[model samples]
Target: MKILLDTCVWGGVCKELEVAGHDVVWAGDWPEDPGDEEMLAHAYAEGRILITLDKDFGELAIVRGIQHCGILRLVKFAARQQASVCLHVLTRYGRELQTGAIITAEPGRLRIRRPDEKGQPLTCDIQGQGSRCELRRDGAGTYRLLPFNRGSSARQTASAWGTGMWEGIKGAGSAPGSTAPGGETND
Candidate 1:
């Protein structure tokens, strides 16, 4: 996989991916900031997946229709945990990402938006699961991982992954502040 690491991503986030044989490049390592729009354009032109903490790319890709190869936005706050989550996502969901999937990551769970046969990316709402949860990008380029809530429509897509899966999805035992039982409920 070809990966473009956003400037905000932790340094080591690329190490494990590189070890896994993915060609990874970082915006921070570049001579200067490529800027968000430019970076997205660069990644798309090169057919590289853009991995970052910036949720604005969602707006760029989904809302604005700025095409991209794919994107995976990590939600962990700490640097170590962020890198760990990156490796975990890549290892567990590599293939889905390869063809073009929009993935959002918190500690234990991932929210994915896959592409259709026509190769157009689907919006969260288009998947019949948009109400599940949403990642909101703040002013500083960080996303607030809203936990999944049990709503009238939300139950239709609720996890059948069981107790341990629930814990992992919620980041219950992994991180200190998060107590989400369903991995940052999408409320």
Candidate 2:
């Protein structure tokens, strides 16, 4: 599967995904900083799954009625925990994702939003107060929920390193941290 990694998620996550045998590209590697809509279009055009840390793509998915591929939104967590959570989800549901599905990884849980429903995607009230992440679809859609505490089973961890070398090859101006990268910081 071809995957596009958003700038915020470009740190070391792409390496793991690459070892999983997926072709990955970073936003900074593109001709310019593709906005959410453009990134979604590019992913759809190329038949690639979009892996992002931004929720704005959710709105894009709804408005564009995109059905080509899926999106994987990663909720903020400790760096170490985030890596482990991502690997677990990828190993378990990566195959299902090939068919086009949206999966979200939060602090202590993972949720799958299936497009096989009757109408649009479904919305579920997320638990965990003060949670920085919530998964919601536009309307009625089926979802499979999984909850895991600490020390979950290990899945696959991509061994490929420097998968984001192209990022370094490109100038820092396009990187996520710079003022010119996106205009506004999440902070």
Candidate 3:
């Protein structure tokens, strides 16, 4: 599969995918950071699957109704996991991800949310205090927090999830002329 990878998942993962005969493109290879919209556009244009560690893509995909081949959103996992673990995860489940589904991988758990899935409000007990979150879309086509906390913002949480998902799809390698930092444009 032709895959566009976010920087977080490209550092050491691209190589593995390449070895497996999958063509991979890192953001650094692109001309720019290519925000969620542009990235999805490029992927769709190139007939590639987006392998990102960003949950915002989910919202972007929903709001714009963009029909991407697929999106892999990493959840949470230990940073020290073995590379083989990543290979196993991706090899076993990568095909399922091609259907525009979200695969979330935790330490020992794996959950999947389809494109048609709507997030429900979650309430958890935090040291006897009630913490609630309603994962709904706002008027601006972004996310709105009903009543969350200050410890971690929604965007951060989403990025973290993206990271884990990327980990599960793991492979390694730096694309040529695409290793520059901070989303610099190639052209």
Best by lDDT: 1
Q: Scored by CA lDDT, what does every candidate get?
A: 0.64, 0.54, 0.51
The TM-score that candidate 3 achieves is 0.54
Model 3 over residues 20-62: C-alpha lDDT tens digits?
A: 7788887866665757788888888887777666778766776
RMSD of 2: 15.8
For model 1, the stretches where C-alpha displacement exceeds 4 angstroms are 117-187
The candidate maximizing TM-score is: 1
What's the lDDT of the predicted structure labeled candidate 1?
A: 0.64
Tell me how many clashing residue pairs each candidate has: 9, 1, 17
Q: Candidates' TM-scores?
A: 0.62, 0.59, 0.54
Residue by residue across 5-90, what tens digits does model 1's lDDT show?
A: 99999888778778878899988899998788999999999999899899999778877878888889987569877766777677
Error of 3 at 20 (Å): 1.8
Q: Given candidate 2, what's the lDDT at residue 35?
A: 80
